[model samples]
Target chain A: MSRSTPLRGVHESLGATLTDFAGWQMPLRYGSESAEHNAVRTAAGLFDLSHMGEIFVVGAQAGEALDRALVGHLSVLAPGRARYTMIVNETGGILDDLIVYRLDEDQYMVVANASNYALVARELADRVRGYDARVTDRSDEYALVAVQGPRSAEILTALTDADLDDLKYYAIVPGVVAGTPALIARTGYTGEDGFELFVLNEHAVPLWNALAEAGKDAGLVPAGLSARDTLRLEAGMPLYGNELSAAITPFDAGLGRVVRFDKPGDFVGKAALERAAENGTRRRLVGLVARGRRVPRHGYPVTREGAVVGEVTSGAPSQSLGRPIAMAYVDEGALEKGSLAVDIRGSQEPVDVVDLPFYRRSK
Target chain B: MSTIPDDLSYTKEHEWVAGIEDGLTVTVGITAYAAEQLGDVVYVEVHSEVGSTVAAGDAVGEVESTKSVSDIFAPVGGEVVEINSAVVDNPSLVNSDPYGEGWLFRVRVEEEPEDLLSAAEYTALTSGES
Candidate 1:
């Protein structure tokens, strides 16, 4: 049986379609996923991200431990700030993309994808063995709720007195929302201004209800995993299983910037990553805009003149572009030289190569 | 619960057939239950040409939604008389009014369908599955 989140009852009350995702029974959508997607772009959308894992690494050398365990230089990150990083194996293949938050001088929170968090926790525990820090999997004790979109700050302002204006992007602050303590972070996967609130499991329902009531006039709707997927795809975010995997390195995914070669330490994947950086990858990740209505799905072959050249990683019908969009890893040379098409169920559908992120919010 | 019209017949694949007793032609479309499961229809295609013969269990077309896609099967063996162009242009019709404006195609009856369920049977099937 799939595990249920703390707000499963609330989701059922709202008539959501529950689907098993990453071993958790989560809401896929409340009503129309398109409406939820639009709500996030225009107004605000609430999300129950409790399925995400939160592993705490706390000690005198927490930052140093993370620096050796992951790709980013976490030792230099200031308190109350988060950085996108990845953990890789000895072969330099990405294990999982993570958000590491420096909560204090000797404490850090590594937020990982639901599917790979268990393995990530084990890896961190083993990787930090020599360091003074200790790893604790606090995923079950926390519930993460996110309010995302243009009016996210406004919705949050009604509940908390924290300086939403002063909170920079990728910053987190401790504050009380709806009489419950929460760690409010200005971070989100959707390409919109948003805040993710981390609270105790007991405080989830009330916090969600308070935000819903306060943001009712601001057109805040509860979004689900379906809308979240499309939102992140439009924002050009890479999912764990689709874009990042143990078989693919960060360099192959065109996300080599996350790998910190300058950091002075023997990280797990340091030698292999340096070699990968020196010898560039054969296939590069690119955005594909479908010329036809058929959506290029995961595992679909990206072909050049009937010859298989690459494979699609993630795809969906883009609401913002009014057409279907996909991300695929194709040969870098074929990208510049020849026409490409996605073999969608035996029929070749033409596609145009575009930059990452099918949609971006105006600043 | 999704609305299942008592006048129409349903297939186990979640398709509804209309005018089965009219003796000439019947309209076919996916049930509302199927549409709700699909969650936002994006693209729809009818593969059975207007003048082509199709077997009862043969796949005729497909409906693509935001989350997934499902094949639209022929409920009964017949000749494809016409396809709904409106649904082809705007696939959202499948979710908005699945039984009415979202009718997929019309078929000239070639035989009496042996496998079909009444409205009550379909409701029971969906309820048990859910």
Candidate 2:
């Protein structure tokens, strides 16, 4: 059975199209997904991210346990800092991408994707068996809502007394928002300035209503998963199943810099990841821009000189770029020549080989 | 709910057929219900040419949204007498005015159409679907 998020009632009352995503009934859109995408790019948009997982690791050796389990240097991270890291298997395959926030001296929170959080929590629990840390999956107790876009800070600053100006990007602080306790994190997946607010599940409705009221004139719409997917795509960020998978590693997806071998102690997949660095990947991910309106979707074959050279992973008609763009895993041969075309339903449409980040914020 | 005009006939495929009283020359397009589910249409491609033959339930065109693409099926069998060049050039009309300016093709009927639903029946089909 598909579970409902804390804000499911609000979404239904607003006439959203609810779809089953990753075992949860989530809102696909409010009305026009393109408009929601544009709103986040130009103004601000609200997102119900309660379906995301929040796992806590608390103890004297919490940071040490994370360093041994993942592929990042988490021990040296400051209290207010957050680091984006990943958990890999013994074969150096990526399990899930995570964000670890050091909340206090003995406390750290690991934010995970809804689809893989259970497995990630289990993995963390098992990895910390000998350590002086305890892993707890507290996803059910918290609710998350994000206000994203260029005008997010202005809108959020109105509702909270916290020092929004002093809060740098990738930093987290505990504060009260709209009369509810929340962890304000200056991080987002949309490649825009935004804050992910984590509060008690019962406080979700009031917080959403408050943000909606505060950002009424600033064009803050209740954005859904449809717009979120496209916004992240425009930013060239990878989704778990689309770009990063159990069969693919960080090195293959052009995100090898995330794995830090220089960190102390033996971490999981360290040996295999070291070999991946010396010998480059066989198939690499590249960006493809369609010459026409045909959207190059996932699993579509990419060809070069009449031979299959790659496969499309994630694709959509980009509203920001006003063209169809895709990320594909191509053979090393195609990556070398930078020449390829996507076979979109038996027709070979030529694609311009471009570097990722199809659209960028002014910053 | 989308508007289902009582004056027109519909297919289970969610297309509206019109101009039937004009001696077998009928105009066809996807109904407003189908357009809403498709989100914002970015591209439209009609496979039936002005003189090509089409059959009912055949995929004669393609409508693409940002996240997905759906095939536009022919509601009735006929020779494609006309294609809407306006919709081909500008696909957003499919969402803006699906039954009027967004009509996909016109057919010179080859035989009697099959499985055409009235506006009430089409309304019943889409009422609790979304």
Candidate 3:
């Protein structure tokens, strides 16, 4: 039996192709994937992301407990602010990458990947057994929706009383959306101006309908996971199962900036990260752009000359750029930008190693 | 759903075969159902060439979309005669008119085609049996 999100019926009504992802049956596309991807890049698009995991940490020692659990210092995060953090195991391998939001002095919410919800909740709960904080898994009760693109703010501000102009990037505010109490966060996986609204499961239908009506003239279309993958890859954002896993470290995954070594508390995998920093990481993630419409796919071997050097973790033809691009984890010394080849179904296709982001929004 | 043309014979794998040149040659392409499932074919790769003898169920080409990559198999044993260059440049033709202008290849039959499902049989294969 597959689980359904709060917006499952809405997706089905729009003639979306459904597939199982992270134990939830979600939409893969609606009509055409390229149209949805281009809509998010050029205009605006909405996504139902309620399948993500939401965990809450409460009590007086919440900040202290979070500091001991992840790599970042959550204590310094001011109220109404959010920071991207990582939870690692004893061997400096990433358990899951999450975003920490300081709801109040003693209250914090951690949003994580849907597939790693149980593991993250269990690990955090066990780590804080002696602390005063309590971990509560709130994934089922909440629903998340993302409105992303260049005109996202213009459309979203009409339905909420919150001051959208003051909400800086990586900020969160307690507010009401469509007459329902919700948490509106200025964060998204797509590299665009966007807001993530978390509302009660029962309120999702009304909120989605309200946003769709308000955003109709602004060129907002309902997008699915297929467009989400291509948009994030163009923005150089790493997907958890693709670019990150239990065996991948922060340094190797191009996420070293999220780690704080000078913090006063000893977090999990602190010593191992220190050692990894001293001796450089073995592999590094890089971006590759193919010459034509043939996109390099996941698990495709990346070779230089005739020697296999790495494998593509994510690849897609960017609807915004009209070309093929990918991300691959290669040796640290092989990070130089040059000519490369991607094995596409027993044939080698020429590629160029350029900068991280394949496309950037014009200001 | 569009009705499968009575003149064409279909396989269980959703490939359509139409007799050409008085049954000496046949044109092959994916059925409309297969093209609909494979949204927006971006690339098509042909592995077999002219004059190469192939067996039924052998992979002759591959079609890639934004979501998946699928193998295009031979519906009947034949010698490859011609490949469709138009679909290679504009793969959306497969979705528009799969049985007509979207034909994939032409082949010379090695023997009389057998074990193929008819249009009605192919429709039954996709009609909510699962």
- What DockQ values do the models have? 0.89, 0.86, 0.61
Q: What digit string (tens of lDDT, one per residue) describes model 1 on residues A136-219?
A: 999999999999999999999989978899999999999999899999999999999999999999999999999999999999
User: Clash pairs of candidate 1?
Assistant: none
TM-score, candidate 2, is 0.98
Model 2 clashing residue pairs (backbone): none
lDDT of 2 by residue, A1-363 (tens): 999988999999999989888999998899999899999999998999889999999999999999999999898999988998999998899999999999998899999999999999999999988999999999999999999999999999999989999898999999999998999999998889999999989999999999999999999999999999999988999999999988988899899999999988999989999998889988988888998888999999999988999899999989888889999999987778866899998889989878888888997
**Candidate 1 chain A lDDT trough over 10 residues, lowest sum:** A330-339
Q: Using lDDT as the measure, what is the rank order of every candidate, best first?
A: 1, 2, 3
Per-residue lDDT tens digits for candidate 3, residues A276-317, read 878877777988889866889899999877567789999987
Residue A253, candidate 1: Cα error in Å is: 0.9
Reference-based lDDT, each prediction? 0.95, 0.91, 0.88
Q: What is candidate 1's CA lDDT for residue A162? A: 88
Listed for each candidate, the true contacts retained, as a fraction, are: 0.76, 0.88, 0.53
Ranking by TM-score: 1, 2, 3
- C-alpha TM-score for every candidate: 0.99, 0.98, 0.95
List chain B TM-scores, each candidate.
Answer: 0.98, 0.95, 0.91
Q: How much is the TM-score of the A chain of model 3?
A: 0.98
Model 2, position A102: C-alpha lDDT score: 92
Task: Provide backbone clash counts, one per model.
Answer: 0, 0, 0
Tell me, by TM-score, which candidate is best: 1
- Better model by lDDT: candidate 1 vs candidate 2: 1
- The number of the candidate with the highest lDDT is 1
